[model samples]
Target: MNAVLRRHAGYYLPFLALAAVLAVFPLVASTNMVNIGVFALIYGIAAIGLSLLMGLAGQVSLGQAAFFAVGAYTHAILVTRYDVHGLVAAVTAVLAAMLVALLVGLPLLRLRGHFLALATLGLGIIVSVTVRELEYTGGTSGIFGIPKPEFGGRVYDSPREFFWLLVPFVVVGLLMARNLVGSRTGRALSAVNDSEVAAECLGVNTFLLRLKVFVLSAGYAGLAGVFYAYWLAVVSPEAAGFLLSVHFLLMVVLGGLGTVWGAITGAVVVEGLDEGMKALIPRIVPGATGEVQLIAFGVALVLVVILLPGGLAQLWEMAVSRLRRRGSAREPGELPTVAVREGPRDDVPGTGEVSLADLLAEADVPERGTVVLSVRGLTKRYGGVVAVDDVDLDVRAGEILALIGPNGAGKTTCFNMISGVLEPTAGTIEVLGSRVEGRAPHTVADLGATRTFQNLQVFGSSTVLGNVKVARHLRSRSGVVRGMLGLAAREEKEIERSAMASIAALGLAQDADRSVTDLPFGRQRQVEVARALALAPRLLLLDEPMAGLSGAERDELAELLRRARDAGVAVVLVEHDVDAVMALADRVAVLDDGRLIALGTPAEVRNDPAVVAAYLGTDDEADDIVRHAAQEVR
Candidate 1:
């Protein structure tokens, strides 16, 4: 109930208020104000498109104007030269623009950050130049005699009547955009934006998702372009130039990056400022109209970037929260929730739902097994250096197996072979009674296997819920189109319930809506674990789960891991923290120079002479100790 109210309260309430204002606006405001509203609506459409691109897809597109122009020109040609209907031409124009965006974004979207920005910028410049040079576009003069739509056999003759006509389309467009951005596909775009690597690991096709968002963004720009051409009865190169594209980007940034209403707010505020300054400049500075306006606009943008990086939406949100707090104050004797707390529960079971025995039985892995993950005579060499040399190891089920060595011990290389990140040159890898060698990482993951990276791999820009949701996608039975259309899947509600349950299990319900960036390092680590758990794998490989954690945080994580093990999940933990390995691991494997020198219970491995000697020696000297120990054991 609270969620429903929160959803409707923010922009929906404002939208309702705006409807009232728009209804009475024509009667109260001047003709100029009405004109401004129409213009703002059109600009809002473009802003919405750019927001989906730059904000949602995490692509920096400085070429929105190019797509915008394609739409406008396509409509102009279809309606005038080809004698097509305005409505049909408009739809065709949008499709044409989307095709163009897809074709261009396919290759260009592969580039990261500024590379994408610059590439799109180049595309915009090419478009602007082409339009200016082409005879069909009327060069610098542009195309004229663009036909306006005649609806119900009556032409829209006046600007006021035209405003009413455009307003509905604008509203419809906004609704569609809202729906697109609010759905699962929309969240996927955000996931890619946040972290492409992590998204891919979660079974998201990042490239395809990028293309999808590019097409959607371009489609919106295309629709807006058609509206602009019909409203002005002109199509020009200047209308979709690089500067115009920048203007759209600035609008989204000034409004808010991720919020939908921010686009409209940004468009209205910035465009109104532009118009107001144009009017005031001539009166105040005489002939310095252009120069003065640019100076003022630049300064305003800098101020916004510095003071309101979250933009107007965040500012408004903060204001409303403050207002609510002020409206109701606590009595002097009333204690805060923070001041009251229940004691810990001794009855609550640990993290996993099943016992270790069950997990081993399900995977057909023995409690004291033969090799579950074995590498024999494994060697990976680059040029003259051998990264992993004739390494042999075994990982048993139902044990916390620790793989630890110095930075260049090829510990990662060994893991790469086991998880199928790299091919072993001279060995076989048998996982779960199959010769699962040289498969892709995803293929490895699909075979009851899941692994985390050594480096932090949380989707930083996405909310805690968003990150976990991506994890659940691997298990989601719904297809892409179903999610986009907001259709009820076979188990849509069930999937949602399951995702929430996973979040709750991680004790992250309080931080569910908060972005990973907002959380501390320890919480982000927990988020990663939550994601892995969502995969529902039998063999869970954790790479340094406690890296960069505080002592207290590490202790808590250790307890969490113990609970997970207790719940029938087999875990493989790789860490350099000897104390943590000793405390949490049922059995430990010590890796030096890519070969396992010692593998036994924590007490046995800790007491191993070779294990002690390897730690005592320098990083380089450890490899010799591993070799000697392996020979001695054999």
Candidate 2:
């Protein structure tokens, strides 16, 4: 109950306070103050869209004001020129904005960071200039005479009346933004922001994701513009000016980039400051309001950058964290804790003796077992560099094959080729005997080949369990549209259960609800592995799964891999840990400079002269000969 109260107070107190001010300000303040409040609400809405672009998808867009103006113009034209109903005009404006966003985003979202910002800044300038020059848009004088929206013989004519009208939309927009950031779309967007290359490797289409977010953000800006048009009963080129774009950018940077509620708070604070400055500067400084306010804005922005670079959300987080730390320090080790039970160890039934034949039979692939995958003459080249040179590999049902190599030996390149990431310069990849080469990465993943990266690629923003749940979506009956509509075929209960199970598989059950960032590095690696295993692929490709793990963790992973193999899943292992590889591999393949050097049983490979030279260097002949002679008879 206390935690609930704290959470509500942390998240909703500002909103509740704003609600009270909006409700009572009309009675206490002048009509002008009420107008200022309404304008703040509209700016808040635009800021949410800008926040989505800059914060979530990691795209820096300064053209939100352009999209904003386009929406206002759309609403103005539809209502005045086409005689469209006010509500219909609002909807049309949003759709039109999305269309413009799509056209702009398809090309502009292709650019990264500074380039994106420059492109968007150019777009905003274009929109501002176009609005000024186009006669249909009323030129520099701006469009006027837009009447208040009327519904069922009722019209909102006064500022006070429109405050009541706009408040609900402001609330709804906040909720919608919150819901979006918490959904799959939000997670994917955050992932893209953090690392586009990593997200692409995870089968996320970074291009389409950027475009989707671009359109969504523009749609929100459009809706806000429509509301602004109706509220003001006029439209102006200033609505899409470079200054307005800068203001939205300031809001995002000040409030917090990635959090929805932060965007809301940022919009209110920045716009409220603008209004306060407008009122105060004119009264105190008389004729210097314009220059004085610009100087003050610049100084305030500098202070914000210096003092709170991570933004207001980080400030709030820091404050709360400090309070929690103080409270926890008062009672050391009393916070909360969880215990994990290890799974039962494998043993011969009621026997003290364990036979090698039995162990080999249990670990071995059966005759006529499903051939889950086949790779034939797979070759990849980077210019004159042969990254993977005519490699042939197969993964049979229920077998674990380890790929061992020194650095730069093309193991990863082979994995990439098989996973459909790098299109092979030559060769065929087949899943279940069906040729599937040159397919997209997601298509290869959908066809039952899932992999984990050498370096951890866990979604740090999401909970540990949430990371795994996303992989479950690969097999989900629901499409993206269906999930957005809350009509996913699988029940929430089932997804939750599956997610928990996957989390448990890697002994991360205790950390399921914890943000992956908070976990130890080894555990984060486990989360990555669990996420890949959640796909339930017929063949799993683990790229250095034991990398950066402790002795205990390596043992746990080896046991987990053994259990997975026993359960009828084929695995391709790539690791530098020779001890673990020798213990776990049924067959080991060695590579040297993108060419296969040796393929044999662990005993044979351990003694192979070529393998020793590739690993220990050719100069260590005395040690190599002794080691080879010792292991040759094994």
Candidate 3:
């Protein structure tokens, strides 16, 4: 319980600090300053949502102002025309915005990058134009006379009161955002941002997760809009204008991309700067207009992007990190080491090597040998060319099936099809009895199959432990609400423990806290393996897992795979290293020119004439290579 309290204190302490500061601001500031604070707080709310969408989820949106307008208009119409209670109307308005976001996101989120940005930009324009034309919205004038919110018959009318009212919402927003980005769901979001395909391969529903964040961010914008309407006692079409959406984006960018506090900081800086320029620019320039302020913003944005791409939050974090490092300076030439658990190992007699047979014999583990992955007549065609043709295979538990072929022989393509990264042009795939040929990767993963990529898909922005924890996403049951409420603490701790075990299994426990990008190429591959192992899948597909490894690293990885197989995991390894394939595989499936040429025990496949021909084209050199590899395996 003390551990849990300590964990939670780290999150809430900042909230209390923020709350205390907000509580004191109104007491000390003048009325104009208080009014500015209100605007900053409102924009801060919207910016927080934007930060989650773009900074964390790696999604871009230009339709946030549309949701903002939806909230303001909905609240204003509800209170003035329908005489709804202010608080109830506020809640309804936020829901309305979220509903609109759901509707828009269903179709719009399908597009990515600039396409999604432009689609949202168009949505903002459409909302702006629609509000101007709609009669109930009061045309271009927009709905007005929005009543102030009341609690127990006490109205919040003054800027000071409104500022105080807004503070709690900001605090709640920050707390929620902070909690979310630090939870399992947040790690999944970071995974999605880093690589959607990889995230899906780990059983993270990328599309659904993206949609949820979109809806949640829209809610934030809508709530801000509700406050905007009440505070101004008016709503206008301009409230949903494209410019306002740009401003929200700008605020998030300037403060920090992925940091929770960055959102609020950005809003305060941008809002404060805008007001300051409006008051100061004319006095300095004698005949300056709002256009000059726009120029100033443009210059500021360029400077921030060029010098501090991670934003002001990143700058502050760097400074703090540097200060801490200086305070705890290590002695020259001394290195930090973390204890790594290498797990139990068995060595083959006279070879000083860990062989598959040795591992199988040493462990008293039972072999289930149940077929976990069944692929029938799998084919992939690229317009006029067949990348993979009529491949049939089955991978059973407690076995390692190495899929090997020469370059362009469709080994990776076969893995892609089975893992659902690519839809088979023809044929069916069943993962643990579920038909999964054309399904999304996440669905296949959900059915107890997971895979690594030919190109490493480690989340470069995260630590090694963080990367592994993301693999445990499907194992946990936390959603945005639970995460935001800090109710997922126990589950998160369990996930970390599990992830750490996997890391330790791969001898990466020492590097658990290190950023994956800082590791060497070979170690990064181990990180990928550790992440895959963390999934605890029945079927594991590895595409070139030993590509960048040294001989020692390869041996360690082979041992790890043997251990996994001993524990009933069916691993399909696509690798070019013939020696590793011959030594480690229970069965070898050889592909040639998009066709499966041979499937049998590693020794059988290695000596097969078809396999030799496919690899070396019936040459004496090819025969020698195969013979030598076979001898090495023995």
Candidate 4:
């Protein structure tokens, strides 16, 4: 009860204060103050969209103002020139804005960071200039006398009347933003924002997810624009101006980039600042009132960025976490013990004392012997350097192949070429028998192939189970709309259950809810494998998976690989632990200087003079007998 009060205190207090304030301001405030409230509410709606795009998807779009302008003009033109009803015009404006967003986003969302920002800035400039020059859009003079929306024969022509009209939409918009961010779309966006390459390797189509967020954000801006048009009864080029775009961007950053409520809060703060600065600037510097307000906004933004870079929502999160820790923490050495439950398990025929093939027969793992992955003539080059050259490898179902080499032997480079991370200079990669040499990483993953990174890509901000669950993206069918509407609950529950099963298989069930970042390096590696395993791919590529594991952990992982292989999944093992590789791999391939040097059974590779001399080195104990014999014969 106490924790609930503490947690919701901040939430409820702000909501009630804002509601009470907005609810009463129109009743008692002057007309100018009421207009300011209207502006704040309207812009708050736009900021929510920005939050989803910039905050959630890690996309920085600066031309949301263009969307706003497009929407306002769409409604204004439709109603005045075409004899359309206000409701129809409003709906048309929203759909048009969405269409424009879709067209722009498909191309622009691919550009990252400032490049995207600049592209959108240019878009806003273009729209603003075009609107001002077009006679049909009313040129520099703008369009006026836009009709007021009439509902039940009531016309909201006055600011006070419009306030009542717009408040409901503002509420609905906030609710939708919350719902959208909590759904699968939000999950994919979060994964993409963390690392696009890593997310794609896990089967997330980064382009598609980012584009969806972009279009949705634009729709919000457009919706807000429609309302602005109706309220002012006019539309102007200034609505789509570069400065307005900058202003909207600043609000999203100022409040909190990733937080929905932060966007709304940021908008209110910006509007209040605008009004306050205007009123005070005249007294402080009458000669430059309007220009000084811009300066003041710049100064405020700089200070907030310098002092509170995470924005207000992050600040609130940090404070809440601290409070919760204090409230819920037990004294040191006085913690209660958690009881461990035990259940019966019927062992497979060969789990403890038989070969993996026997275990496969007993455990009923898949038995399809189809070739899962086939790589032929794979090669990659960088300028004058050859990274992987003419490499041909075949990975079939139900076997583990260890790729071993000394440092800088291009083992990872070969893996990259096959996994779609690097475009091969000349090669072909076929997964399930279709060429995918130059396909995107996500595309490769879609064809039943996925890989783990050597450096561990854990999405650290999420839970261990969360990390595993996100990897199930390709397996689950519940999408953005279904998730946001809460219709994907069954799929969500199934996903979590599957994640837990994966974790349990890897002996990580104890850390399911733990933040992966809090785990030790060894545990983190386990989580990475768990996430990969969740993909349920026919081919699994593991890079240095045993790098940080202890002797016992390595043995456990070896058994896990056996189970994976027995279940009809092909496993690619890249490791420095020769013993693990010899025990786990059915075949061994060695690379040296971007070329395959040895390919055979582990015993054959160990005994091959070329492999021993090139990889094991002249001083290696594996070649001691040959070296000694040669010296004696000499």
Candidate 5:
């Protein structure tokens, strides 16, 4: 409990203090100011939704106002025409809008960049036009006389009462927003935004996650729509149009893209400034408020984006951090690096060279020779060009199989086909007898064979622990809904612990929280391998895992591969380092011109005439082969 409190105290304490201020502000402020605050809070709820979709998910939505309109129309038509209670109508309205969002978002979410933005913008236009043409929607004018919430024969008719009611929407919305952005799914969203390939290989279903956030953001807009209806007692076509969507987008940008406080800050600042300017400008210089308000908004947004691109939330966080640091400062720290945590390493004296024999004793490991991955006639093509033609391979439960050849030998292509990174042109790929040839990369990962990239695919935006924890997606079943509600706390903690253990086991304990991007090239390569291992794959496909390591590091990798095989994980490596391959692999396959030129135990294949001619070649080519083989890990 203390750990939890200590971790979240920075967030909770300030929130409570702000809540106290908000709770009493209406009582002390003038009626007009109180009314402005209510509108700002309502706008804030929608802004938070936009922030999540755009800032975190890397989606651009321009249909927020349409969702808001859908909510308003649902409530207006239901409550005014059907005599439904206001709160029930509000709930129905939000649900109706979400339903619309669900139907629309399915197709829109698939489009990328400005394509998605334009599609969403089109949705807003369609909603506005449809509402304008419909009689039930009040055509041109919107449905009016929406009822206020009533309980015990008293309506919440006053601005103060409505303010109190809307306050919870803002508070609850922000809390939920914060909750989601900090959860496991939240990290997946960031991972998706940062690198979709990296996230998918870690087993994140990017398309599904994007669709979920899209609908949730729509629901938020819907809630705000219902609030607008109740507060104004009217719903108009203008409420569902382009300008309002632009305003919401402006709020998202002017504050900060993905921040909880920025969402509210943006909404409050934009709405308050516009309304305040309209009131003050007309009195000072009659009938020029709209133009002046636009000018102010343009200038303020430009400055915010140019100066503090993180928005007002970032500025606020910086100020708070500075004030807190003055009272309790620590020495300036260096970027993190991984070191082994003291345990068996300390007890065993001298580096207890972790070997295959020690790892073979682990309880979970299968016996030395179980079937893990089997590929039959695996072929891949690019148009008329055959990349990996009719290759057959097997990786047993406790053995390393190295696929090696010259640069254009299709070694990487064969690995890609097996890992589901590339769909095979013809033939079958399976893990333990289950076919995975046509499946997605994520599906293959979930099926227990995850691959690392030839180039590093670490989540550069996330911490080292975060990168590995994402690969543990299959290990935890607690999902987006449970995570947001904080119901998955126990399971999530276990997942974190497991990720940490994997990091520690890899001798990365000291750098468990470090950014992968901040690490050296060699360390980044290790992080890539560590992330693949963290998936707990039954078959691990490593594309040059020893790429940039030193000689000692390469030896460490050779031992690591042996250790992995001993632990009952099948290992498939595509490597250029011939010496390491010969040392590590139980069997070797050589490819040339997309054909298997040689396949046998290392000694058998090494002496094959086909391998010598195709791979080792003439004196100059053999010299090239020798140079490639001796290319040091680093």
Candidate 6:
């Protein structure tokens, strides 16, 4: 219990210090400075939400100000016109903003990059124009006479009082944001950001996850809006303008992209700069316009991007790392390179010095010969081009089936169709008896199928353990709310243990906490396999898993696959290494020009006259392909 408390204290001490500073600021600062602090805290809440959407989820939004205005105007209207309680009105306003985000996000989240940004910008414009023209919104003049929040017969009416009132909200918001970014949901969001297709194959519904983050972000903006309405006791159309939205984006960017503290730091910096300019500009230029402040902001943004692209948060991290390194003996960012102790040698030829019995022993082998994947007449076409012609395949438990062909033979297309990354032009795919041909990738994954990509899709920004943990998405049941509330701590620990087991099984335990991008290409491939194995899939698809590996690495991977087969995994490997495939596969299926030409035991397929003519083009090449297979089987 003490150890857990100490760990949590280390994690939260910075936030507690920040809250203390915020609480003490109003007591010492002048009224004008206190007012600026109030605005900063209010905008900090919205900026944190935007950070989660853009920084973590990699979804861009340019309509945060519209949501902010919705909250402010909704609260103002309810308080002034209907005489509603401030607390109830605040909740209602936040819900209204979330509803708007939900309606807008359903279709808009489908768009990517600048298209999504533009769509969100249009939404902002529509909201701004509607609020300006509507009578209930008080048109261009905006709503007035908003009531101040009262609690226990005490009213927060002054700038100092409001600043103090906002400190708790900002602190709670930061705590929740911190909790979320360290949870399973946050890891999945990072996975989606890194590779949406990879995340989907790991059983994450990318569209739904993006939509949920959007709605949550809008709720944050709305909460900020509620406070903004009460702070001024009036709401204006300008509050919902494009400029405010841009400022919110700027806050997150200037603070840091992926850190929760970046949001508050950015809000404070932007607000402070604006206030400083207002006071200093008049004295320097006598009649300087607001455009001068805009120019200053642009210059500052450019400088920050060029000098510190990761923003102020990056600078803080660097400083803290330096301090820790100075105090400790170890160098910063240095990871241990200790290898796992080798086990007893096995009977398998060319199995190398390292043994995998300890690694593979824990896998629960099902009844052998149980068919795990079935495909019949599967086809894929692009206009006049047929990528994959009618193909039939079945993979049973306890066997490794190699799908071999030349480049552009539609090997990957078959894998894509079977894994549900692409819809088949015709025919069916069943994994563990569930029809999955036209279903989404997540659905396929949920039915106990997982795959590794030809071009590596490991999450570059995450640690090896982190990458593997994302595969446990379907296995874990915690959602965004539970993650944010820190209710999934126990589940997260179990996930880490499972992920570590997979990493260890793949001989990557030493590098488990290292960022995957820092590893060699071969190691990264191992990471991908570790992630896939963590899913505990009944059927595993490997699109050239051995590509770019060394001879020794190839042997290691081959042995690993054999162990997986022994453990009742159904593996379909697509590869160009004929010797490795011939020696490793129980059966080989050959494809030529999108058509299956042969399927049989390695010897049977290699000696087939048609396969020899079509695949290798001659008997000499076919002989060369099977030289190793004959030696291994004998």
lDDT, each prediction = 0.74, 0.76, 0.86, 0.81, 0.80, 0.87
CA lDDT for candidate 2 = 0.76
Over 1-634, each residue of candidate 5 has an lDDT whose tens digit, in order, gives 5655676687677567657777898999899998988888888888889999998789998889999999989999999999987778889999998899999988888899999999999999999999999997899988888778776677778999888877766776787788888788888888888778778877888888889888889899999998899899999999898999998988888888778678888988888877776677667776775778677657766876889878787788799999986856655784423453333322222334332233223224445687788888988889999988898877888888888899988988887777777889999988777898978778877777788888778888888878888877877786667766777766666556566656665567688767778888888888778777777777888998888888988887787787787677889889887878876788889999999988888777766888888886657767565455445321
Q: State, as a TM-score between 0 and 1, how close model 4 is to the true structure.
A: 0.90
For each candidate, give its TM-score against the true structure.
Answer: 0.80, 0.86, 0.93, 0.90, 0.90, 0.93
Q: Mind giving the per-residue lDDT tens digits that candidate 3 earns over 231-262?
A: 89999999999989989998999898888799
The best candidate in terms of lDDT: 6
Error of 5 at 534 (Å): 1.4
Candidate 6 TM-score, C-alpha based: 0.93
Native-vs-model 1 lDDT?
0.74
Better of 5 and 6 by lDDT: 6
lDDT of 1 by residue, 211-261 (tens): 887888899889889888988899999877989998888889999988767
Give the residue spans of candidate 1 off by over 4 A. 1-12, 327-400, 406-408, 412-448, 453-455, 459-463, 477-492, 507-523, 546-570, 577-587, 599-608, 616-634
Candidate 4 regions off by >4 Å?
1-31, 284-288, 334-368, 618-634
- Candidate 1: pairs in clash: 352-567, 354-567, 354-568
| Residue 109 C-alpha lDDT in model 1 | 81
Estimate, for each residue in 90-136, the C-alpha lDDT of model 4 and write its tens digit: 99999898899999888887788899999999889989999999999
Better of 3 and 6 by lDDT: 6
Instruction: Mark the regions of model 3 whose C-alpha exceeds 4 Å error after superposition.
Output: 1-7, 337-367, 616-634
Clashing pairs in 6: none
CA lDDT for candidate 3:
0.86
* Clash total of candidate 2: 0
